[model samples]
Target: MFNTVLVANRGEIAVRVIRSLRALGIRSVAVYSDADADARHVREADTAVRLGPAEAAKSYLSIPAIVAAAKETGAQAVHPGYGFLAENTAFARACAEAGLVFIGPPPEAIDKMGDKIRAKATVSAAGVPVVPGASDVDIPEGGFAEAAAKVGYPLLLKPSAGGGGKGMRLVHQESELDAAVESARREAKSSFGDDTLLMERFVTTPRHIEIQVLADTHGTVLHLGERECSLQRRHQKIIEEAPSVLLDEATRAKMGAAAAEAARSVGYVGAGTVEFIMSAHNPDEFFFMEMNTRLQVEHPVTEMVTGLDLVSWQVRVAAGEPLGLTQEDVRLDGHAVEARVYAEDPARGFIPTGGTVLAVHEPSGDGVRVDSWMSVGAVVGSNYDPMLAKVIAHGPDRASALQKLDRALADTALLGLGTNIDFLRGLLADEDVRAGKLDTELVDRRLSELISSEVPAGFFVAAAMDRLISLQPTGTVVDPWDIPSGWRLSGPGGITFRLRTGENQAVVRVEGTPSDASVQVDDAEPVRVSARREGDLLEVRRANGVERYRCADGPQRTVWLAREGKSFAFADQEFTLSSRGEAAGAGPVKSPMPGTVLVVKAAEGDVVSAGTPLLVVEAMKMEHTVTAPIDGVVTELSVRVGQQVALDETLAVVSAAEEKQ
Candidate 1:
């Protein structure tokens, strides 16, 4: 076994690899960028190296820097823990040349399967069922239309060298093909550095299912069943589960056999994934999509259900050890489900959010596992992916696992910035989601219903009230150790607390004495709260639940409250509360959540009708244009381009117009 290994990735996966290395008695070396000096993964490594700046293109993707770090640390092997340069064929080959094993498939396999078009051709030739698509070489503007003629309308134009829905588009009309091609090519070039894309006959409603395959240096390959990743948005997976509710015993046997054959055809080694699109409407007809040459983000669900550690196995295989487990030995124990928690807001068009994580408390239970890299007061930079953590749960059956997952998601609490937390919770309760009638287009098809539905305002008010009570000077919230509070009366039973999001302002009514206050937003119900030190960490809860409602900071107070992934913070609004009924409530257009103030669509003098986009706020990797609430004359516009905003912060002001008779 290798004495030491270098992890060539960051965040939760880095921590995951280190844990595995420690269990195997191997020293782990972690590499970090300037933004990651204090990152949890770096802190946990046995030894660490500084790579470069926070920009991934300059730091994480720097192969020479990583190789040098490995040499400096005397690591016998390098583990590309997915993402970054995980599938970079050059990186694998260079590692080999440097006398260090790469803990994944060989460089040859990467090169062969890295290109989607070629991989499909190779696998199809090996008797695997591949989707009917035009090769990248034959994907000219004119050729695309021709291919669609043969392949049929509703064809998919996908980048030959990308994943996660980037640089891909589905065309339903021939007139839209030209523009879609140009746009997809542009995005593909920016993301993958290769503009090559292929065409495929698009399945109307297909389940995004893929089989995990493992290969050994000893010529043995095995498939580890399928994972359902059908529920997605823009090709990015939101919900994933193993032991798919759709597959049957006979279908599993055939898909597994085909997956194994595909691996063998390419002389595959180590771990890889064979992606397929199953027509849920017609399960008998499935087609190959692409192959991932590294560990996928959804690997945890597979891990829990299969009772295996893919990372550990990768290391063992790279060390020239054969895969000890055979197909028959691969037993599917139960069901597993996962939800990715991201630092992006759903209402604001899901744009990536940037802020310091003020507080974080992960969910814990019998079958729940949270893979994360954040603690308290971690600065979230715009240079990286905003995914904060992954929450997974496993059980003997799908229903039990789902119930566990719902509790797990509801239990996770965070403060600092807006997230899609509430959105994910809504997905769990969605009728279609609960029934397993998911497909690649499901997120798009039901985008409105999912985003607009959730717990009532009482929850937000309750959460806000919880934050208020935890902030008292005498009865203050403390870390871990026990601490008491002194009761003191101040100016008013309620004090004025103000929070600014862009140009919008949220005037909240916090009803209580100086010691404790009940938060009432608009006309929402209030929740009880108390905060004091118990042992090592400060604990606060909304009412009396296992979950903790809290905030943490570096120097300044950074606060966060989780609403699914769309948690909100009101640090700028920390003032004494007063009766809201007396103060003249200002007509403020507050930011609905934390996001980027993208565009000020309306000017100060412009009179607009209801539904007119006053300005656009982009959040959680999506774009949303905030519109006018009613027909009114714009009195004052208070925001600009490229501004960071919090929930319920004002955007602009408008005077209501007289009714048209």
Candidate 2:
């Protein structure tokens, strides 16, 4: 066992590795960038080291810096926790050259599997069926059209060097092929420093399944069944489960053997996963997709069913220890499901969101496990992945596990940030998902029905009551005027507050004292309500029933509330009325999030119709186009390509022709 292991990663995976090292009585060292100076992983490790700036190239991906940090800390081994330099063969070799053990497969194995083209070739040579695709590593300019034609339409342009859907583009028509290839190459270069790509047949309604393989220095390899990762958005997995309900015992055995064979062919050691894309129309058929040469973000589901600590095994295998269990000894006990909780908005094209975590209530109980890096007061940023945590549940069967997962998600409370918790719950509750009829395109197809735009009326009521409660004076006073309610002898006695929830505005009127209040939301009938503040929780007793909400007040009359399985933020228009006075109509184009301007599609004096792309902003590695809201002429272009802009900063201004009239 290593006396000290330095983790060359950040976020939840680093924390996970640290916990596993502690369990085995090994000292852990953590490396962090400027953005993660106060991260949970830094606090969890036995010792910590500063890598560099917030940029990945200057920090986590800096091989020399990481190697030096490990050497300075006298770490016997280095663990690359699934991202950053995890699958970098050069980084692994550097650690080995520095006399430090890499807690993963050998550099040779990583090199073979890291490249999608080479990995498919290697696996196919080992008798594993691979998808039919063009394996040409390089394509000359102007040749993409011819190459894409060979692979047929509806194919995928994927970076050969990286995963996580970073450098992937799907094209359904010949017209989209050239642009998709160019975009894929650009993203590939930016993400992996490799412009090489491969074209693969995109199977319609395919199910993503992966087999977890564990290997040792002694050539012992074993498979831990399969995980269904079909529930995905934009080629990234959202929900994953072990012991896929789609696979029968016979199919499972065949896939497991093939995965094991692929591992052995690469001389793989430690934990690696063999991914396959299986057509839903042909249940018994599958093709090799790619192999991830490190621990996966969704490995917990496999651990739950196999009863094995994969991280512990990674360390043991790297230390030249034999895997004690054989193929016959492995047993999958029960069903387990994992939902990735990300700081993203599923309703808004799954855009990444960054904010300070005001509060967090992770679900806990029997059969529920939460692996997270977020806590109250942590600042989520655009420099990294948006994933905040993973909630996993285990049960005796698939149905029970799914039920447990839904309940676990409902109990989760993360305030003051946009998250996919509600979206994940929606996915688990879908009829198609519940019936085990799933595919990679299921979420995208049913996205409209899954994402609810309606905010419950109770939420607005709770927000109103919370704001009113906050206005209470510290001193003990019984006077009605002394309270937040502006009541007078003249006009209506009820005080009306302007609040906005989503796109809907509410005018809430409050009458009577704080203890006994009558509330009327919008134009609805007035309802008598009894409300009391108990610490951070607001208890409201309405005509229907009583409800409790966890509420927190923010600056500028903002209130955040969490109830049931939802978190909402409501802005009070009181401040808007005082400072901004009236709502401004049709302002300039503003950046939604902090990012750099990528493309300026329109210039000053350009006449454009509504919904025309004005400019494109690249933030958090995702591109968002700012479009014209009305048929207008561009009056000013305030931003330039490659210029970084802050959130809400004006990028352009368009004057509507109708406004001029």
Candidate 3:
């Protein structure tokens, strides 16, 4: 085994790799950008090196800087954890040129499998069934319609040079072909530096199943079964599980054999994944999607089920070790499920969120494992991926695993920012999901039902109680005059707190002190409530029952609360404005998240209808288009391309059009 390995990534993946290195007694070196100087991975590694600025192009994605860091740290090998340059063929060759081992597939294999167009041909030649599709070269000039007619409707446009759902579009008919192509090409160029695309038949009700494969220098390859990654949003996977319930033993063996063959055909070594798309209606049929040339984000689920440390094996193979076990020796012990916890808000179209983490509570105990890089006071920014951590659970059966995963998510809490913990719990509790009736579109289909926009009454009550406690005199000073007990010399006093979250607003009225108070939310019946704070937790007692909330005070008088996996950020109206000046006659178009304005679609005085795209804001490699909310002319345009904007910053305004008599 190598004595020192350099981890060329950031966030949870870097922390995860460092953990494996520590377990194997290998010294780990971590590289970080300016934004990640205080990242948990940097603190955990044996040695840390600064690559460059926060911009990924000059830091994490900079091949020269990473290679130099590895050489300076005297690292014997470089482990490209998942994203950034993990699948880049040039990085692999650079390692070889520098006489440092790359703990992944060879450059030739990466090059062959990196391009989706060529990967389909290579895998097909090895007898692995592939989806019927057309490439850019396959289509004649201005012949997209002809190609679509031949391939059939509902086709998928995938960037040949990238994966991870980036630069992918689903076209249901010829009418949507041109726009889809334009968007896909633009995103593809921005993400992968290549706009070349391939079209494939969009399988109805498809289930994403991938087989994990490991290969050695001695040409021995083995499959580690499959993971079901059908639970997704915006084409990105949020939930994954190993030992898919959809596959029987016979089908599992067949898929595993096909996956091994695919790896062997590309001369693949180290850890890789062969992704397949299977139709929910036809379980026996499967089509090859593409092969990831490095360790996957969901590798923990596979590890838990197979009882193998994939990273350790990757290092052993990179050190020129032969296979230590045969295919028959592998046995999946139990089922495992993993839910990705991201710094995003599912209520607002899953837009990325950023803030300082004020508090965190990761679950523990039997059957629960949390691979996280989040810590209190960690500043989460929009400079990179929004994923904060992953919560995985293992059990003897799928039902128990799902149950444990739901319970674990309920116990998890991260205050001071928005997250998808509640959304994940809701997804796991879906009747169809619990029954294993899963498909890629299941989340999208039930998104509205899963997301609750109504703020629970308890949240408002807790916020009021928290404020009431804070208003009381502290430091052993007991002054009856200073007490905010809603007490008066003549009669009882009352305090009112107006709180707002997004479009929802609530007026909380409190009478008396924290121990004995009558709380009423937005004209609702006053209920007896009392609350006490213990560290970050706030215990509130109400007429119904006692509820505990993980609470934290944020900047600008924002109260963050988490209970039962759900989180809320309530802004005290006394300290902040009730609205962002949206009550005026003009409809303001605001940036959904903090990001750079990539494209300005409309200008001042331009008439646009409702839902017209006005600007596109790019953050964390994802683009969200701001559109006109009403049929009117663009009265004001406040931003231009390449300008950095904060969340909810007004980008433009549309004055309502005059009504004709």
Off by over 4 Å in 3: 574-585, 659-661
Error of model 1, residue 189, in angstroms = 2.1
Q: Which of the numbered candidates is closest to the native, going by highest lDDT?
A: 3
lDDT (Cα, tens digit) per residue for candidate 3, span 174-270: 8889988988898889888899999999999999999999999997899999999999998899999998999999999999999999999999999
Q: Which digits, one per residue and each the tens of the lDDT, describe model 1 over residues 34-78?
A: 999999999999999999997677799899999999999999999
**Candidates ranked by TM-score, best first?**
3, 2, 1
> How many residue-pair clashes does candidate 3 contain?
0
Per residue, candidate 2 scores C-alpha lDDT tens digits across 403-498 of 999999988887878788888888899999999999999998999988887888888887887777777777665676666666677844767788
**Superposed Cα deviation of residue 148, candidate 3 (Å):** 1.9
The residue-level lDDT of candidate 2 at 212 comes to 97
Sort order, lDDT high to low: 3, 2, 1
Supply the global lDDT for candidate 3. 0.92
Residue 606 CA displacement from its true place in model 3, Å: 0.5
Cα deviation at 586, candidate 2, in Å, is 6.3
